[model samples]
Target chain A: MSNKARVPAVDGWFTMDDEPKLLASRGVETGSYFFPKNLAFSRNPAAPTEALEECTLSRRGRVWSWTTNHYKPPAPYISTDEFVPYTVVAVELVDEQMVVLGPLATSCDPSELSIGAEVELVLGRLYEDEDNEYVVWQWKVVQ
Target chain B: MAVEGRSVSDVVVLGVGMHPWGKWGRNFVEYGVAAAHAALADANVDWRDVQLVCGADTMRNGYPGYVAGATFAQALGWQGAEVSSSYAACASGATALNAARAQILAGLCDVALVVGADTTPKGFLAPNAGDRPDDPDWLRFRLLGASNPTYWGMYARRRMEMFGATPADFARVKVKNARHGVSNPNARYRKLVTEAEVAASPMVSDPLRLLEICATSDGGAALIISSLEYAKAHGVTNPVRIAALSTVTPSYPNTLIDMPNFSTDSSFGVAAPERGFRDSIAHAAYEKSGIGPQDLDLAEVYDLSTALELDWYENIGLCKEGEAEQLLNSGETTIGGRIPVNPSGGLGSFGEAVPAQAIAQVCEIAWHLRGEAGDRQVEGAKVGLTVNQGLFGHGSCVILKK
Candidate 1:
């Protein structure tokens, strides 16, 4: 893992740093926030015609809901040849009031999660190639 | 936007047909052609008599599937019938049905044929092939690894927390639907399931076992719709009439965590609608039909997951919110009970053929209303409703009356 270059599976989704946060876009007129950045258009009815501004989302949130996947999803979802079950948590962002879904940190267990539990964002490897590690944002319950 | 009041002209279902729901390993066209012939025969009309044809688009079979209306017409030996195709994920059949209704109401056609057929892939459905990072469907799978069951599990977990619902409640939905399936001749899974069996099944997602969720299957269903005047002219009376067709999109700031979405729309700027998307779907149907839940003799809901079926109970106003399990326990949702749901076994037994499932729901309603659903029949069935919500915020409801 040491020699592999770490890269986001998709660019412009989130940042990789000490305090990671999801990249988002906010409608300038309507004040509506969008995840994965609404690069094309705004869905706001009041201010349907407006430009979106780039922004960083809240780094911490509460668990709105959680689940564990016991089956491997078909592609284009990348996974190891020997698949392992993983947990996913829908985190309700404190500031945005929007529930964002993502896989839990590799260390987290599904049995330990509860609704309203606090969690923070962290970048984790989704899958790795010989030369690169594809990373995506994951949620970890705050200890 | 509010839907206009009731339609001016009423559309009637002259006949319905299906190719059954299962993994047949056959071409979709064959299934569609078979269903079309069956429906035409059931309607007692020749292919040459159909003035319009509407087909539900399927994603798997390339251009022919996309241009389903013409594909089916060609297979059935077209005689210059006007054609239209619609695609709305799982609601494709309803879209096709509504398109036919619109044509009949507009005096464009007196007799119309609506067909939906799909040959689904064996496993979990994947996004369309591409490396396009922008597609949300692709992005969700690539970034979060969130399968369809993962979303269902989240909703189930949330319901358990908010409503004090237990896993057993979810299991009971399967048990009930499975029991109903035992009597449905066209259902894929005809064996009855028990709560113990459901609980023992391997977990697909937390709070959702393998038995609690529906699988993909290959199937076809078709309907023959005609104007009430046309039906009367053709010496048919008291046919099952389409009282209302509600096809609605969610209001802005859709709060539900729907499929293929990474996050809920932020409710920060605009206030969310009073009713959730599913509730609004049923509400629109109620408004258009001028009928309340109390008037429904039976209902056929999209039970993609057993837990989701419970959600539909409340969404369709069978009972108040957080009281679906109570209704289920009271036996009101069973075949003999009041407001019996999924008497034809629903997606729990039928599995999902995507395009065909919604049409199949209407077909089941037609059978029960005509008192022709041998064994699975609901006694004295008059008014029936079918509700289905599709990916990307498409919701459909069809109200039928004998």
Candidate 2:
């Protein structure tokens, strides 16, 4: 990897730590979790907007479903010189009781995963420019 | 079956029409106007007699597509008729229909027209051109490169893992729909498809081949509806009537992963709803019309993917969960089965025209109810239903009876 600066493709969605967790908002009264940190208000109608609070989501989950994208998607997706098919997975967190979707780590093969395979969140480089690397959250198999 | 103590009067479908689905590279307004004219002629009502027009908006075109109600009205030579526009992604057609039906029920207008049409681009349907990171549709593409097919593939794979649904089972859905399409003059792909053909087609998303997934196309569909009194006054007797319409959203703690979203609603705090979002769409209609699956002579479900059709079979209560493949294998969902589905070829043959699709489903159902569908008609078909869902939380279902 080049010694360029590391930055998030979309800022404030996650942290750049070695073991990353998704930043999210939770309904203080209802306990509902929202990814990407919804500070606007509580999605639950039973709760008030003042009940919303920011928090980090669970870092580990089980694969609820998965698939391989065989074709390159159109933009705002940034692709490298040659497009490579990647595996997308939906992982269900036990505590949150919700399924979150993301791409598998670049080093992991899709064949290595099953419906209930364990996975953990990680930070990975999505695309890189000359001076900086754009990163996003990815799911890695928990061996 | 009818809703007891029902205060709302039924809306009669005076006539229905469609512009043939294809890759026609033209202005969407042309298709909408053609469909509207055909509907007016079929209803035998003068265009000037139409009191209201409800339009399903298309995003592909510019401001005109966004305000499609006025767009179609202007193209059809506006006579100062009241107009309304609605957009709920794939459910736009049904939503617009519901809008017109509600107006008629509220005594706002006696005679109304519902129209939806679209002229799609070449490839995958992308989000609006912008750099907005706040949009989930845009963020999904920018962050994970996950296209719509990715979700379809995952759903198919989940069915395989949970219910042992094989790829062959999914292919058979396409084959059956393709056979149905051969008789539908308005379908985009009329050629019969075989399981081998489905298998041979390229795979856009694994576990789902290109042929098994719907393609985007240009199309338009329209319906002229009115109060029962209005239909009777026009000398139209025994017209098909809209019995129920459900345009509901997902309940709190919706756990099912849906399209254009990164995560499902967390159910840790709030308890999950009694019914999943998809199940609730048709359930609400069934409750409203008091017509269950057993009463349905035929169904027109959004078969965005062949597997999704099988999922709809269960969601609409044609079969129990994990038993849709069994229903398919038993020849129950085929054209000659106990409850035929997608006799109009579904999205498998027509592809998708976004705004026009849900209305197209209604048109197919109304045709069957009125004994107007030539070869694809279900024998003695009386009651029919159409179900579709848009991106985010839009849920749509409509039930009709002769």
DockQ of each: 0.85, 0.88
Model 2, position B201, has a per-residue lDDT of 95
Q: Which ten residues in a row have the lowest lDDT in candidate 2 chain A?
A: A43-52
Looking at the true structure's interface, with contacts defined as alpha carbon pairs within 8 Å between chains A and B, what fraction does model 2 recover?
Answer: 0.91
Q: After TM-score superposition, what is the CA distance of residue B195 in candidate 1 from its true location, in Å?
A: 1.2
Supply candidate 2's per-residue lDDT for B8: 45
Query: Candidate 2, B390: how far from true, in Å?
Result: 0.4
Interface RMSD of each: 1.0, 0.8
Candidate 1's DockQ is: 0.85
Each candidate's fnat, listed in order, reads 0.88, 0.91
Off by over 4 Å in 1: B1-8
